[model samples]
Structure formats: C-alpha cells, structure tokens
Target: MIGYLVLALLGLFVVAFYAGHRRAVASVEGDVARLHSRPSQHGLYLALLSCVPALLLLVLWSLVTPAIEASIVRARFAAEVAEMSLPQVQAFIRDARAIAFGGIAGFPDETKEAAAALFGTLHGWSVRIAVVLSLALAAAGYLYGIARIAPAFRARHMVERTVRGFLILCSVVAILTTIGIVLSLIFESLRFFQQVPIYKFLFGTHWSPQSAFTGAGAEEGAVNTDIFGAVPLFAGTLLITVIAMLVAAPVGLMSAIYLSDYASRRVRAVAKPMLEILAGIPTVVYGFFAALTVAPFFRRSGEALGLDVASESALAAGVVMGIMIIPFVSSLSDDVINAVPQSLRDGSAGLGATKSETIRKVVLPAALPGIVSALLLAVSRAIGETMIVVMAAGLAANLTINPVEAVTTVTVQIVTLLVGDQEFDSAKTLAAFALGLVLFCATLALNIIALRVVKKYREQYE
Candidate 1:
C-alpha cells in the first residue's frame, strides 16, 4: 500500500509539472523573455512544491502509523500481552502482524487472532486516510504554486535553495554514519578488552579465542590470555600484504609507463581495457584460480626442487591476490602518468634526455603523489582481501614469514569466527570486531603514510 501510494505521488508530480509548464507559457504569452525564470524552472518548482510536503507527510505517517496500530492492538489485547515478557510481547506483536497478512509462523490463541483482525482493519483504514490526505495536500500545493508563477517569480532561486538544502542534508547523513561506525568499533573493542587483556591480545603470540570464555562465565581474570594473542594474525596479514605489493608495484608501474610512453594508439586502446578486465573478474574466481592452479603448480615446482611447500601456501595466495589487484594499481598509475603536463616531457627531451630518462626523472616525479595514493589504496585492498587468502593460504595463523608455508590473514579469521549463529556476546565472536579495529587502524596508518608521501614528493614536482 505504501509503495502504491508513493507511485501515485510521483504520477501526481509529473501531471503537476506539465500543467504548471503550460500555465507558465500561457502567462508569458509565448514571450519567455518576460518571465524571470524559464518554463522548465517553473515546471520544476511546481513539481517540488506539489510533491515535497506530501512526501514528508507520507514518511512521517508511515513511521507513526505502525506504532499507533501496534499500540491500539496491544490495548485491545492488554490482558494477553501483559502476561508475556517485554521481548516476548514484542515478538507476539510481530507474529500478530504476520498472521494478519495471512502467514503463520507458529500457533497462537484466539485473542491474538482477534487482535490481528482488528490490526489489519485499522491499518487498512489508516492507509486510505493517509493517501487521501496526501492527494489533498498536493492539490493545495499545486494551486498555491500555479498562483505564484508570474512574470516576477523567482523559480530558479527557490529551486537552488531547495537543492542546496538537500545537499547539506546528505552531507550530514554521511558524516554521522562514519562517526557512528567508528564509535561502534571503539565501544565493541572496549568490551573485548575488558574480557582479554590488551597486551596479550595485541602482542601475545597465539590466537585461540575459542579456548576462552566469552561472557559472564568468565571471572575478572579467568580468561585465557595466551589464546587471545593477536601477533600471528597481524604478522600473517603484513606478510601477505607485503608480498602482494612487491608483485603489484613494479608490474603495475611498468605496465603504466609502457602503455603511456611506448604503446601505439591502437595498442593502448585494446591493451588498457584488456589489463583492466582483470579487475572486473570476481575475487572468488581468483580464489579458485589460486587454489586449483597456482597452489598446485607451486607445489609441483617446489617438489621438483626438493623444497617443502604446503598445499595451501602464502606464496600462492599472495601471488594470486597480487594478480587480482594489478589492474587497480595499473589503472590508477596510468591515469596519473597521463595527467602529467606534456610540456615537462618535451622540456626533458629538449635537455637531451632519452624517452626512458624523461619518463623516469620527469613524468614519474610529477605523478609521484597520485601514484603513491594509488599504491596505498591498493595496499589497503590487499590487506582486506579474504577470499584468495582463505582458498590458497589456508586458515592456520602461523607466525612465521615463510611463504612456502600456510598462514591466515586477520580478515579470513574474522570470517571464520563469525560463520554461524554464534552468540555475539562470546569472546570468539567479539574477536571479529577486535580484528576489525586492528584492520581499521592498519588502513588508517596506510592513509597517513600516503599523506606523508604526497607531502614529501608533491613539492619536489612543483
């Protein structure tokens, strides 16, 4: 019903726009120059005036109606609901709503059925009243807007103000959302620290949160401190990220340089897209390629050389993950390199520098800030990647840096720990949030590095 009402409002706005447009034209007597605003602005102003108030009212009604209906139903079924706990009563109300819509998840009493029928009837009447009121409001707005559309009307100014207000609202929402996420992470990490000591969690060698009690069953100091150690996870994450960067940086940068400086127009057109196609391929597909192809190939080659290689090795995962992220680095670097002023390259050439020297010393230095930003972004991506690491590197949080052995990343562990309907209050589940905090900090550090890098090299180019 709400969906249909929204559609009706949109249809009304469309009609109002065209009607207002024709009325504006008639008022101007085909002399558009006489009007302070264009016919389109008049149409837009009318549409907004007709629709915005109605939409706002509709949203408020939608929020209030459910609470009002639930209150009435609860009042009618006061005796029955009073016997249930608050949570149970809330669940009962949800069940009643579901029953009213003709789907029963479970059995209920006759009083509940009576309540549901009354709930459905009340809800139906409310929808009808709301829709009628909405149309009336829109009609009133249309009349007011049409009367206001004169030779001296400032539709464009009104429209611009409305748009600016909307933009400010969107900006506030985004800022609030980021603050909320950061606060949630901080609060959850604080809870986690209360259970496990921060020193042990951050610096201890092993990670076995499963062995520790997660809730009130835990005493003030009863939790296993050793198992909560996060050093291995952090180590594994850094190792894999470093390996991925080692693979991505040179290859992506060289590709960018070649494409920018040497590749012909026809070749660049085809090759650039072909290289970027790697980014479009799903990471899960990359995981499969890592596990079945890269891992096995590495294992066989290792065996031939009489070296010990795990079936799922960090080398395989890192290499595959690197291959997956190459497009990101390459694409960003290519754009940055292309954005460097051509005159700098021409000056370098005139100074007797070869094409290679021109690119290496001049273009690259100029594009350093953007390229550094790109590489940092890619490193963040690599650190957060879970699929390829899970499939190729295996889920053992090994502290060693031997690429031939298996190691798991923080992201993979977070996923593994939260795979089922586990109690979130448990230490094991809360560990995911802790890991998330660590990941957040790691990414934050990378961003700080990017800023410092840009600050350091950006001035040199200028």
Candidate 2:
C-alpha cells in the first residue's frame, strides 16, 4: 500500500513538473534568461515541494503504524489478554497481524481472531486516512509552489540546497552505519567478556568454544574455562597471512616490474589480463582446488621428504590464498609503478645509470608508497578469506608457526560459531562478536600502519 502511494506521488511529481515548467515559461514569455531560474529548475522545485512532504509522511506512517495497531489491538482485547505475559501478548499481537494480512494463524484463539478482524478494519481505515491526507497535502503544496513560481523566484538555488542536503544525508547515514556496527560489536564483546574472562580469551593458549555450552542447565565450570583462549586463532591467522605475503609480495612485485618495464607492449597486453584472471576466479573454486589438489600434492611432497605434513595444512590454504591475491598486488602495483614520473628514470639514465639501476633506484623509490598500499590490501584480503582456509587448513586452532600443520583462522572460527541456530545471548554466540572485534582491530591496525608507511615514503619521494 505504501508502495502504491509512493508511485502515485511519483505520478503527481511528473504532473507538477510539467505544470510548473509550462507556467514558468508562459510567465517569462519563453525568455528563460530574464527569469531568476530556468523552467527546468521551476519544474524540479514544484516536484520536490509536491512530493517530499508526502514521502516523509509515508515514512513516518510506516514507522508509527505498527506500534499504533499493536496498541489498539491490545486495548480492544485487554481483558482477554490481561493474564498473559508481555511476550505472550506481543506474540498474540504478531499472530493477529499475520492473520489480518491473510496468513493462517499457527495457534488460533478466539481473542486472536477478534483482534485480527479488528486489525484488518483499523488498517483499512488508517490507509484511507493516510491516502486522503497525503493527496490533500500534495495538492496544497503543488498549488503553493506554483503560486510562488515567479519570474524572479530562485528555484535553482532551492534545488541546489536540497541536493546539498541529500549528499550530506548520505554521508551522515554511511558514517552512522559504521558507528552502529562498531558499537554493536563492542557491546556484544563486552557481554561475552562478562561470561568468559577477557584475559583468558586474549592471552590463554587453548580454544574449544563448544565447552561453553555443552550440556543442559550448565554452570560456568562446565564451560571448559581454559578453552576460550584466542591466541591460537590469532596465531593461525597470522601464520597463514605471513605465508600468503611471502608468496605474493616478491612474486607480485617482480611481475609488476616485468610488465611495467621489461615486457613488450604486446606481451603486457596478453600477460596482464591472463595474470588478472586469478582475481576474477571465486575463492570457493580456489578452496576446492586447494582442498582437492594442493593439499594432496603438499602431503605427497612432505611424505617424500619424510616431514609428516597434515593432509589439510596451513601451507596449502596460504599458498592458494596467496595465488588468489597475486593479481591484486600485480595489477595495483603495476598501475602505481607506471604512475611514477618518467622524468626520474630519464634523470637517472642521464646520470649514467643502466635501465635496471634506474628502475631499482629511481622508479621504485617514487612508487614505493603505492606498492606498500597494494601489498597491505592484499594482506587484508588474505586475512579475511574463509573458504580457502576452511577447506584446505582443517579447523584446528593450532598455536604453532609451522606451515605444514592444520590450523584455522579467526574468520573461519567466527563463521563456524555463528553458522547454526543458536541463542544470541549465549557466550558461544557472543564469542563471534568478540572474535570479530579482535579481527576488526587487527585489520584497523594494519591499515594504520599502511597509511603511516605510505605517508612517510610519499614525503621522502616528494
């Protein structure tokens, strides 16, 4: 119904725009420059004046209507629901609303049926009232705006102001959303810490969150108190990320240098896209490749060396993840390196430097900041990866630096904790948020370091 009303408002906007443009043109005798604003501006002003109020009302109605309906329904059946708990009454109201909307009630009752009928009647009346009020308001606003559409009216200025406000609103919304997410994570993590000691979660060397909620009517003692330690998850995540960077950084950097300087235009044209194809492939496909092919190969190679490698090991996941991130490092670094001033290379050559020496000393120094930023981006990508780790590195929170061992990352554990149906208030569930908070912090710190490094190198280059 609100959708229909919004569509109707859109139709009215078209009408208002045409009407206002025609009136403005006639008022100015088609000499638009003489007027303070153009016919288009006049039309836009009319449309906004006619539609914005009605749209706002519709939004307000949508927000307030449910609570109003719930209250009225509760009052209508107050005696019948007097003995019910607040949750029960709320459930009944919800069921009644569902029934009114043509859904079958799962638990039917006379009071609920009565309330549902009352809801249908009240909702119909509310819709009728809202329609009349919105249409009348739109009509009044349309007429008011048209009356004010004089030759000297500053309609363009008004539209610009509205546009500015809209942009600010968008920015504010994005900022607030980020703040809300951080606050929610912090609040949930605090609740988790209340149940599980923060020291144990952060510094302890064990992890088995399942023990947190193992049996019915369990006490804190039943929760393997030693198991909530997150050091292993952090260690695994870092170890995998390190391996990925070790693979990606040198190879990707060298590839970028080759494409940017060494390769012929024809070779670059073909090779760049082929190399970037790695980025386009889905991570799940990589995971499948890692699990089926890479892990087995690593196992066999390790066996040949008599090195007892796990079938699913950090080496397999990290290597595959590194392959996935290579294109990011290659493509971004290539672009950044290409952006370096050709004058620097020419200056180095003029000073009797070889091509390789000029590239190494002049071009690389200038492009170092962007290259560092690219590597950091690739590292973040590697850290947040889940499927590749889950499939190739089995979900064991091993605190070892050994790349041949099975290990799970923080992201994998966060997904594992929140995957199934579970109580949100439970320590087990809230631990996901704690892990998320830690992960967010780690990523944030990496970004800060990247920014600082970029700033320092950029200053030196400048």
Best by lDDT: 2
Model 2 whole-model lDDT (C-alpha atoms): 0.91
lDDT of model 1 at residue 248? 94
Instruction: Report the Cα lDDT for residue 94, model 1.
Output: 85
Question: Could you give candidate 2's per-residue lDDT for residues 1-462 as a string of tens digits?
Answer: 767988999999999999999989999888887889989899999999999998888778878998998899898889998999998888899899999999877798887888999999999998988898898889989989999998999999999999999999999999999999999999999998988889999999988888775644566445555678999999999999999999999899999999999999999999999999999999999999999999999999999998999999999999999999999999989998888878888889999999999889889888988898889988888999999999999999989999999999999999999997988988888999999999898788878888887777667656
At residue 161, what lDDT does model 1 achieve? 96
Give the per-residue lDDT of model 1 (tens digit) for 1-462. Answer: 778879988998898889878888899798989999888889999999999999999989989999999998888888887889998888888888888988874667787688788889998999999989988998899999999998889999998999999999999999999899888888888888887788989999988776675534556647665688889998898898888989999999999999998999999999999999999999999999999999999999999999999999899999988888899899999988987888999999999999999988989888988899889989999999999999999999899989999999999999999898988776778888999999999899988997787666556555
Error of 2 at 388 (Å): 2.8
The parts of candidate 1 lying over 4 Å away from their true place are 102-115, 214-222, 451-462
Pairs of residues at least 3 apart in sequence or in different chains that clash in candidate 1: 214-427
Which lDDT value does model 1 have at 244? Answer: 91
Query: What's the true lDDT of residue 312 in model 1?
Result: 95
| Candidate 2 residue spans exceeding 4 A from truth | 102-106, 213-223, 262-282, 296-311, 456-462
